[model samples]
Target: MTADDIARWFGEMDAELGGATLFLNETERQLVCSRKLFERRDVRYLDMRADFDQLSDRQVLDLTKPIPRVQSVPVMALMVAMYLGFKEIYLLGVDHDHFITGTYVYAFDLKAQRGKDDSVSSSGEILTSRHDDFQSLARLWRQYRVLREIAAANDVQILNATPGGVLDEFPRVDLDAALSGR
Candidate 1:
């Protein structure tokens, strides 16, 4: 998620959401910490370091050490969940379809009104494009596979509750059933 998404969530649903823990990179944590809403709310920010190396081998993420950067925030979130001892992790809205659509649009910002077009990096750099040029979407899939292996080894269950799009690394579950503990 982008800074705008975080801001919007806190801005619009601050009361309903209660509290949130944001796992952000150093730069992102600094940026988010500067926000007024975050300062007043019960929000905990964790720092993660950038790791450009692809997940070439199966490994478990050690949270006590520096958390390695993944292809996206959702993947990073999965690592966080595992580290937090969540045995049954249910993923919601983890659609990895940017490669298919060739855009960086998110499910919440489908109209492209809040993200992609006006997204600014944590380093205060203006990003005009909707997609990243460096990494291929395939790398994301590979990272998910690595996460799946890690989850299996740790005896954790990861169920993807997303409606559609890519990301077939984990078993799919119905969102409603998962939410209701069915």
Candidate 2:
């Protein structure tokens, strides 16, 4: 999700979940802080860049292992889960292939509509864009390869349960089969 999506979701989530934890990278933190959303009492902000464990080449990512630098926030989140010692990590909605169409599968559509209504869309496509950079998406695929090796070394099973997703680094399991243990 984009920074705007994070901010908007943070507000909406606050109403339903009551002060949920929100993860932010530097750019996202800047955007949220500038809007004064960073000061909210119901929200706990995690600076992903600063908070994750840094691993060296000899280190592994596990409950006691440090996380190596990754290309995306979702990867960092996975690392955190690994640090928490989850035996199986099932990934859903990881539609990495949408970069081919220059769109995100989980786009901030309602937010986009509001922006269009308020003329925010007219400012520039780049400013309101939710698409990942083409090169960055390619890099993300490479990062997933490394993550797969790391997960295996730690005896953690990373299953790609996203049907039709382009991520083929991990074993693909049908969502129903994964949930039913079939």
Candidate 3:
């Protein structure tokens, strides 16, 4: 089945998108994550938190009935995908260098809104709104190494779609054939 099709079989729009896949994700942003291509299958809502099994099977995405799955760390999303019956997780924008290095996809000033309290407002909640901007690129590189090592140790095959950067680290695949199930 197509990756998108597989996604539908596994989870609905309110389900989790693996952490590695939340690109430009914010509670207020309806941005489509290139890595988690399933969001493109239909419109998705940015939830700033992970609700975990709170959504009913028959639930629909709307004003009253919302999908409980929210923005979470990459590992959380990956774990959820494992349960979704996806045999192979194809990554389209697994650009490690972008994060491992100092050049994150985008930047924002968190300190600007230092004292904003989220007590009564539900709509104001920012899903994982923004990732922690690591001050030390070197530290991020170390964390990245650990993440890669964990993936390698687990033998969960990751295919990088950028066609550049360090791809030889993971098993390469003829994506077209895989998509066609050839």
Candidate 4:
């Protein structure tokens, strides 16, 4: 649902699926091109990349331009929340500090996978990972700010409930406070 790469999973699982398919961008690209050639009338695709010139001045973020590259999936999730008419959005565990430690939470065998083509970094070094470097980290924050503007344009509020996260763009609230409707 987030990108074209995952669309094939829907087709592969469509045989046992019962829900509607919602893809981003072109529906045909997301479907009918995979190995199974899946197609359904219930499938719907939403294209949020309206031309920057056509959008009102209030909608400041030009997602179509692809500038200030987004480093996290939460950006897309936030946009989807806006489309779904969510007025209050709270985030948790959306940390971008994995680079600070030069390791991923899932990379349990960083030593064994060092220098592998698919591994996070070359030379088997874990401390020099640049994925979370200053520029990349800053981009994540800038993208979140853009999401904040977009949310405001749609009369929505985004709160960062991520405990101790480096992200300081949005107002941070306690997770319990958010969940208790306080």
Candidate 5:
């Protein structure tokens, strides 16, 4: 079934909160970027409110497989989003800043990144408003790079959503239509 089809099925489940758009990610960038891109009236969150995995696992046990050696918080969050039927899941502020200190960071691929932990990167969009955080831009950049590839094949649409970022690797998402609940 397609993402929309899954969404429709999930909607019928008793635990759903209407036809809501959920924000599943960490603080800093993903929160800011997802909010901007996945703009909708009932933008629910999965961070503290509800663990995406726990929210609906029976629906995704078949989809989310544990990445053996991969460990990025943004990527993990992305996995959770996918589990919850969020096909068009956007990694808003997921900039790959923390990976730069390591030389093998370049080994990160889209489907399965090679990082040791959740310290990926930031999107720098929301951080744009906070100048002091400028020093942390590199990590977030790398995150966008690897995440772009993983998201492509999964039927999930990952976009940068920054005002003017090129994202030579990822595609820009059209939020206008997706958020309309059409």
Candidate 6:
């Protein structure tokens, strides 16, 4: 999501999310901090630092420290969940197929009114803002493997509930079955 989108959502949902804590990476925090959303007394921001290329073999369970980044926000989020002591994490809509699909799409884009120039759209246009080179894409897969290792070491089960995708680092499960504890 863009900074404007985040600001607008916060403005609309500020009252309803009174006690929620928002976690953002340093870059994201900088993007939305100027909007004064952080001024809210009830809103707290956890500034997570990103480590772009390096993959740690062990789990980084400390929320106060920097988490290793795996080129995808979902990986970082999984790290946060593990840090928060979640034993099982079910990943949904993590297709990780931007290179194959040649476009960036968000799950909420169906509800958003986007313009032609919008970076995210349902039209499947290639995003010009950021391009992931072949090496970077390869690194993403390697990072996922490392993340799987870390999850195993921590005894955390990482399940991929995405219908079909290239993210095979974790075990695949049916979303309905996983949700119903089958």
Candidate with top TM-score is 6
Q: State the C-alpha lDDT per candidate.
A: 0.67, 0.60, 0.40, 0.59, 0.41, 0.69
Task: List runs of model 3 lying over 4 Å from the truth.
Answer: 1-76, 83-86, 98-155, 166-169
* lDDT preference between candidates 2 and 6, better one: 6
Model 6 residue 27 lDDT score: 58
User: In candidate 1, what are the lDDT values of residues 1-182, reduced to their tens digit?
Assistant: 67676666656645454666545555556555677665655544445564535444445676656656677778888888888889888888787665555455444423313433444443334454535533446577767877889889889999999898688999999998877988
| Candidate 5 wrong stretches, greater than 4 Å | 1-65, 97-150, 163-168, 173-182
Writing each residue's lDDT as its tens digit, candidate 2 over 6-41 gives 677656645555555554444456666687774655
Model 6 TM-score (2 dp): 0.71
- Residues 17-82, model 4: lDDT tens digits: 566454344535535455344456354444444432243455534333432323566776776676
Candidate 2: stretches off by over 4 Å: 1-9, 16-20, 26-55, 58-71, 112-133
Count of backbone clashes, every candidate in sequence: 0, 1, 3, 0, 23, 0
Give Cα distance to truth, residue 130, candidate 4, Å.
3.6
Q: Per-residue lDDT for 29-147 in model 3, tens only?
A: 42235435354444434443433334333222232223334322443344334334344566554444443333333122222232343321233332222254333333434433333
- State the displacement of the C-alpha of residue 116, model 5, in Å, after optimal TM-score superposition: 17
What is the lDDT, from 0 to 100, of the residue 120 in candidate 5? 36
Q: How high a TM-score does candidate 2 get?
A: 0.63
Model 6 root-mean-square deviation: 4.1
Q: How do the residues 1-182 of candidate 6 rate in per-residue lDDT, one tens digit apiece?
A: 66677666666555455766666656556656677765664433454555535544576457676655457778678877887888889999999777677776755533323553454455867655445446666777776777778789988899999997778889999999978989
At residue 14, what lDDT does model 1 achieve? 51
Give the winner by lDDT: 1 or 2. 1
RMSD of each: 6.0, 6.1, 14.6, 6.5, 15.9, 4.1
lDDT of 6: 0.69
Please give each candidate's TM-score: 0.66, 0.63, 0.32, 0.60, 0.31, 0.71
